[model samples]
Target: MSASRYQDLVAKVDAKAKEFHERYAAQLQCKKGCSSCCQPGLTVFSVERLAIREWLNERPDLIEKLKAQPGNPKACSFLDDEGACQIYPVRPIICRTQGLPLSFKVNERTERDVCPLNFEKDDVLALPTDGVLNLDLLNTLLVLVDQVEGGSEAGQRFALNVDEVTRT
Candidate 1:
């Protein structure tokens, strides 16, 4: 998708993220040093590639670092020397919603997914479950916006590998 359109969508997602953090600050311990969810071999749609390309444009030094060290399939390419995300502000939707309470369908029943690091406290268990970001809806919106902005209109075709994106 076009950079401007992607930025708008990112802004909306970020706003929701901010709200989620505010609502569950104590329970969610996903801090900068925490890279447990940062794994490699992740696949993304074309729109995410476009967004990451935009993010890479500003961090030329990081690009050089990535060039010197090819992305490892077992580790996230965007992680810095300090284990912090190099493109945190412009990270993809999956990255943005990492530790939040996510719900999904399983065996014809609704199942809730929570990070093992989070919501362990009894007080947090009473927290509203509805506040978690709806990934299915978010992905649909991403594809819709991407198609509207001249991005690849492929349906559920996650063709872009994270390793390839880290290089060029």
Candidate 2:
């Protein structure tokens, strides 16, 4: 995709993210330093892999820093030792939806997980009234990626080895 187009999508995604945060701020108490979701063994989609690789390619020094880090296996390539995304402005949809009350399909069944902090505090009651949590913005970004590279090809191709990329 063209850089201008990517920038537009990034802008929209960032706006949606800010709106999401505003809509959920009262119900979510997940402050900084909480890295519950930044665990090991998370498999990102090929598009995300590509985006991170592109980001790293532009910053060779950061790649070297990541390689030198200890015990950083299979985590999101964008995550730093401080447990924050290096490219927060362009983080993937899944990361963007971390604390929302959203639903997803698994084996033909819809399941939900209220953010642990929200669930524990009886904040689930407020989520329903917070308006629709549509993921269309994210889906649109993915579609754009697919258009740039054929969908099937993009889905199957993994550009970087997570372990090798993370090794110092």
The whole-model C-alpha lDDT of candidate 1 against the native structure comes to 0.70
Distance (Å) between predicted and true CA of 18, model 2?
1.4
| CA shift of 114, model 1, Å | 1.9
TM-scores of the candidates in the order shown:
0.80, 0.69
Instruction: Give the lDDT of residue 82 in candidate 2.
Output: 64
What is the C-alpha lDDT profile of model 1 across 14-104, one tens digit per residue?
A: 8888888898888888889688887876666566776776667677887777667656666687776677887776677778888887766
lDDT of each: 0.70, 0.57
Using TM-score, give the best candidate's number. 1
Among all candidates shown, the one with the greatest lDDT = 1
Please write out the lDDT profile of model 2 over residues 1-168, one tens digit for every residue: 346444565566567657867776776655554556665655545556556566667778876776666655556555666677765655555666676665545686645566687547654434453343444445656667645643344554342344433323
Q: Candidate 2: lDDT of 18?
A: 75
